[model samples]
Target: MLSDTGYPGAVGSDTYDLIDRQLVHALQLAPRAAFSRLAAVLGVSDQTVARRYGRLRGAGAVRVLGLTDPERLGEARWQLRVRCAPDSAGAVAAALARREDTVWVSLNSGGTEISCTTRTPPERADHSLLLQHLPRTPSVLSVAAHCVLHTFFGGAQSLVAKSGALSAEQVAALAPDGPETAGSDSPVPELDATDRRLLGVLAVDGRAPLAELAAACGKSESTVRRRLEELTSSGALYFDLDVDWRIFGLRSHTCLWLNVVPSELAAAGEALAAHPEVAYACATTGPSNLHAVVITRGARELYTYLTTRVAALSGVQHVETAPTIRTVKGPGPLPLPSPRDI
Candidate 1:
């Protein structure tokens, strides 16, 4: 079992040092890699790698889980901002987190703002979690939903890219071959029963053992391996690393909603993607055509980023910032149930 030295607490930079950061980057490459393999790749002992990962996991600083492509599952991903009365924001956010469909539930802007990402199925569109529930609650002041159109960059790969710990060669070695085709606009073939069962286990742990996964799906090891590869290549599934940035010296996370001229939306997104501090930036379908998540050491740093960095961008007319008070659900998708269960 892993030691609980940093468990159930926020680990500062002193507790999770530079070596821990490298290990995190390694996990970004192979989320479920064996300690021996990670040790060899990272030039550390197997025990060291294992211990580090244990402490990080125990501290709630990092998590590795399998995630399904929403589009492949024919689900819509929505970015939502909810405003509630000061006394009831926590209750509302907690309520949202309890629902199976919600992810990344966060309290922001003191205690009155809640931001979250929700995956809604087509059948539940009219009766969505927030839509169906929030309106009935008197505490909820207003809610706005933005559809996630195109993801230029986010998730595990983007996290590692911002780390700058690995050299180009190391990155190349860690990168999976072929492009990310998940959530493609082109038609995706329907997933079969076996495919759904296989995805169920993977959603819990992306790097689950071949034999274990084969048993779960009632298939031979070789068959399961082939199917896993096929699913990845075909864009049916993908993996992401989930971790808190505070362990890496980034003590604050803030989301920036920007109103950029329509013509410059793409340009602004591309520019935000290049910044190391910008973890996620994409175009959405609201007045704030561009949405960005940024990490910094403190309020002062965040202020500088807003004034000097973000303001420098052309065509940016308005900017709204909300600092994350707490994260209730995930930095990545929660484990999805099997299709039948859904």
Candidate 2:
């Protein structure tokens, strides 16, 4: 157990892994689940859960926060395809990724496009505001901004499920037809090589035209469309509307990692994540028990936020903020190579 001094050495890595997977799974199952319920179901003491969770936060493995809907909150989302000069893509991407409004950023096709997601604040985040930062960045050849109409991936869930611990019977008992399988937080559908390839493409560009994706995957657009529909329906994939965060007057981004009193974690987590500033929240294995990515507009705004704001919530024992200097690779499709791909 971390001493009051915060040694963080009492909980070992093995213990953290077991609970971390379980925590994410539980979250996958129910985003707003209280820690007490999760601990009871997972068969661990609440204090242990809290201790280990603190460790996970220290490890930067997970975060718990509210997934705000920008459109509902009166903001717009955009995808920027930035083209930079040779060897300059990395630098340009680094600069662009640092802004609080830049939620997601990545380089693809050997850096031809530095893809990113940004929220347009109601007053300051117009298309030109986006370009305004790039000209000063150097080596920014061109920038293409696509207004996001739909999302196929990357929305934060209130909870996650761990399919490893729960049996098919248990899943059926809890939520038989909800959305996921007993042992898989990932929605299930049989995907062929082409389907996997298509996912890879979408991971980079959810807006990839069906014709383009089909050509890359060597399939027809109709076949691609039908397959995509099946994948989404089966819950293997989800759409992302990609709303912008800035317009809603959300001006700051802070990562809040807390070690809640596990006995009260269940109720506390739900209440804490549901708070307004929390934009992406998750419960994971802990040393940093809970990780919450918060948003606000400026320094003064954030100062008012934590001091006059979130500090009032109950069950919060510890909170730390890491001003995000950059998001190297923002959350999107986390597709990975199967064992064979190795």
Candidate 3:
């Protein structure tokens, strides 16, 4: 266990249990909802909810982050699978994670493979800087880049929400009001400098207060609110709930590459997305068109899921599994320097 003065440890003993799982689901439903409101929804006292939230946050088990929609910004998102020498895999993966361009990074294939996602502006999508650097590194054995074509489910959704703790009605009640239709008519709306600044702050902490956002963006509270609403309406910005999977006894983290019949691709992707173990699923352009991430309690649970849930899907021709040994970087905002530093 980490001392109180130090950073939260990976998994505190017994910090996660049935009630903790329920609370995580509640937060997943409403990432920035008020404690009292969440308390009412979960049928617990406000203090209980607050205390649990504090514990989870202090343990570094859960985090709420705001992310910009790359598609909305006309940026191309790429998934890179890189194989490296066993001894140098950690160095390679860490190097990729340290770049501001990469967001999600995982070390898989018994620590010999690294997988990550990065975005490139429209004009430079063909030649991302990270892509250029990897090939020149002697440690990298091979690399395959897949352009994400479509997401059946998973940017804003959380794996914790799939635990079935809350009913549909409860989730609907807790969900924040979505933006009204306004700027979505255009497929791509350009973001100005102030919009970028606003997004930079939001990315770090989605629940930042209006006053702080106003001060950072040099705008009035009302203006900041209106801009935020407009950004959401246009699909330019959204929030994601992230968690340390270890806390939930889900130690097995694996990525699946699936080749499904063309006609049944959508059906297959949707079915996988609905599984409680799945955290991410998307269609991409590569040898395997569909990619998914699953976390489970252990190898046995993973086997059950693959044999029963996954194998049951029709039209799945082949599946490849790469179990992640360590997470170089999990999902969230890019590791950019803080706004103050900038």
Residue range 1-342, candidate 3, lDDT tens digits? 322211134455465776677777877776667889988988889999889888776555666677787766777888889999999998888788777678778889888999999888777756555557889898899989898998877776668777777778777788767643235355545788888888888877777788989998999999998888777767777777667776567778899999999898999999999998999899998889999999898899999999999999989999999998877666665333323334
Candidate 3 regions exceeding 4 Å error are 1-8, 178-189, 334-342
Best by lDDT: 3
Clashing pairs in 1: none
RMSD of 1: 4.9
Q: Which wins on lDDT, candidate 2 or candidate 3?
A: 3
Model 1, clash count? Answer: 0
Q: Please write out the lDDT profile of model 2 over residues 209-265, one tens digit for every residue.
A: 778889989988888888766665455564332222221333345555566676755
| Structural similarity to truth (TM-score) of each candidate | 0.87, 0.44, 0.89
Candidate 2 versus the native: TM-score? 0.44
lDDT of 1 by residue, 217-326 (tens): 89999998887777766666667766777666777878899999998888888888888789888788888888988888889999888888798888999999998877
The candidate that achieves the highest TM-score relative to the unseen native structure: 3
Quickly count the clashes in candidate 2.
58
lDDT of each: 0.75, 0.54, 0.78
Assess candidate 3 and give its TM-score to the true structure: 0.89
